[model samples]
Target: MQVEVISSVNEACSGKLQHRTAIVVDVLRATTTIATALAAGASCVIPAETVQDAKQLTKEGDLAGGDRFCRQISGFSYGNSPGQYRGKQIEGKRIILTTSNGTRALCKAMRADHIIAASLLNAEACAQLAWELRRDVVILCAGSRDSFALEDGLCAGLLVHCLRQHDRSGMLQVDDFGSAMEALYRNKANVIMETLAQSQTGKKLLRLGQREDIVSCSQINVLQAVPYLNGGSLIQRLPGTIAQTAAPLC
Candidate 1:
């Protein structure tokens, strides 16, 4: 298995993701929010690239969510907070989500054979699924403001580390950037929360009074549910579920 890591959403190219498993990481919020929503029993999360698209996608019962400049869009139901998605109100509801960077990364990875939404919360599960897919991997980090965010890079590194662990045959080949991320993850493994709290996006969230989001997004491997793109929506696939049986659990 070959693993390559893109530094940020801006660095992702559809050509590079073709026929590969693309894991999108936005640990500070976006991907983490998706995973939390799915785990909390939301039907599906439809990622939109723009606020207009998100609004257009929403139906009567659908919830609109997103963030702009690190703040929730005025008319949206929620912002880019994992804790907000975990609410009981979101149960069995469809969410039209648009984030500053995360959803854009997902859109960029649409050309891949499999698109997996991942974060530090579910890195191991995402890595296992990517391994089972039997394809080369591309990890796209949904960095903040078109630049690499340490939190996203840390999640990418964690995924790389998990992938390496899964492929015990020593056949896993990671690109230079992936290797660097893996090193970063290893170095910060013991201080995951602290690392996130100190990241660029993390500090921004703090300034925005979203420290809970940082705390929620920092829990490594606490969630067994993996969120992967199915058509235009993201749904959960549990650890042992076969691909054929993977359906929306909303």
Candidate 2:
């Protein structure tokens, strides 16, 4: 059905997402990092809206990682870089994550019936899963610092475009921002990686000497992981499957 794109957590909070499917986008890093972590075999990711929350969520064998405004938070085990989460070292461990915007957005949309983490890395998989659920979808972008972020919007656009391709019924109702984002994705499809590298968040990371992270996070459709919030954790699932053991929470 219906498709809408929320530019910020504030926008999401002003509306009702309860019982609806939400795909949260933070393409510059957070969502991309989470998907990469899962693909690398991290057991699950627990998003914390604040550093305090992240510290509280950490337990034995759990890794505490996150950033604030693209800088690694003091005492964090790792920053929100997808490259830092590869290989078997992080396997089977829980990640307590806190971010400048993404985790806060996740917390704000916790009431949604379904919440999937989306990045350029897992856009297609997320769209396919949302289509299968047959629920109204909200593409909620974790905009940087309460403002709209280009990378997140572009990823939302990609999700919308993929959803439109899968819907043969011609009933995909897209709101104004959704249409703009879809067009943005289509228009910039040719130089997406380059464009993302030049985005605000991308540039910020670069100034922080994290250019490799930008390149890694900008990779498109390299992961099939679809991480969703369930039972106080974000668990990875296939396009058509879900976490059966998850308990409902909002």
Candidate 3:
């Protein structure tokens, strides 16, 4: 397997993304929010790069939602918070979402053969899909404001850790940066809370009084909802996945 990490949306746009499986990580919120919505039984999640594009897709009564710079848009029903999606009403509903960075990364990575939203909420499932597909993989981190964000990198590293743990063949080749990310995850797995609380994006959220989102996004392996892009929208692939409430990481 050949695996690499694209540290920011700019890098994703500049990369040759064809014939690859992209695991998009926006751990501060976007990817985490998608996972929770899918786990709550949303029919599909449509990612848009702009607020106009997100609103235009409401033809089928798709719920328009998103945020820009940590502030919810004025007309949207919900912001980019994981807690907002853990509801029974979300079932059978399609969400048209746009975000400051995460959705833009997703749009940039659209050329890949497969695109999946991932976070600590569904790290193992994302890894399992990557191994099963056996495609060239790109762990694309949705960095904030065209620069790197620690939480996304940490989640990418978590995916790398799980992939390495599951692969006994020792044949997978990871680039130096990927290896360093994996090492970072291995070394700091015990201090996830502090690590997240002190991260740049996390601090921004903290200032906005959105502390619950930080805590909610920190839990690991709690959701089986793997949100994969299919036909311009992301839907949960839950054929035989475990259905249960999310739990905190160890």
Each candidate structure's TM-score, on Cα atoms with residue i matched to residue i, is 0.95, 0.94, 0.93
Question: Please, what are the lDDT tens digits per residue for candidate 1 over residues 53-164?
Answer: 9989999999899898689999987888888887789899999999999999999999998899999889899988887778899999989899999999999999988888
lDDT of 2 by residue, 1-250 (tens): 8898998877886356876799999887899989999999999999998889898889888999999888889998798988889988889989999999999888888888889999999999999988877678898999988889999989999999999999787888999999999999999988887888888888888888988987897778888879988887999989866445534321
Clash count, predicted structure 1: 0
- Clash number for each model: 0, 0, 0
Q: Which is the leading candidate under lDDT?
A: 1
- 1 or 2, greater by lDDT: 1
Candidates in descending TM-score order: 1, 2, 3
How do the candidates rank by lDDT, highest first? 1, 2, 3
Error of 3 at 239 (Å): 8.1
Weakest 10 consecutive residues, lDDT, candidate 3?
Answer: 241-250
Give candidate 1's error at residue 105 in angstroms.
0.5
Which is the better candidate, 1 or 3, if ranked by TM-score? 1
What are the lDDT scores of the predictions, listed in order? 0.89, 0.88, 0.86
The digit string of per-residue lDDT tens for model 3 on 1-250 reads 7889988887875355788889899998999999988888888899998998988887765678899999999989889998898888788899888999988988888898878899998999889877666677899999999999999888989999988876798877888878888888888799887788899989999999999999999998888668899988998874245334422211
Off by over 4 Å in 3: 238-250
Q: Could you say which candidate leads in TM-score?
A: 1
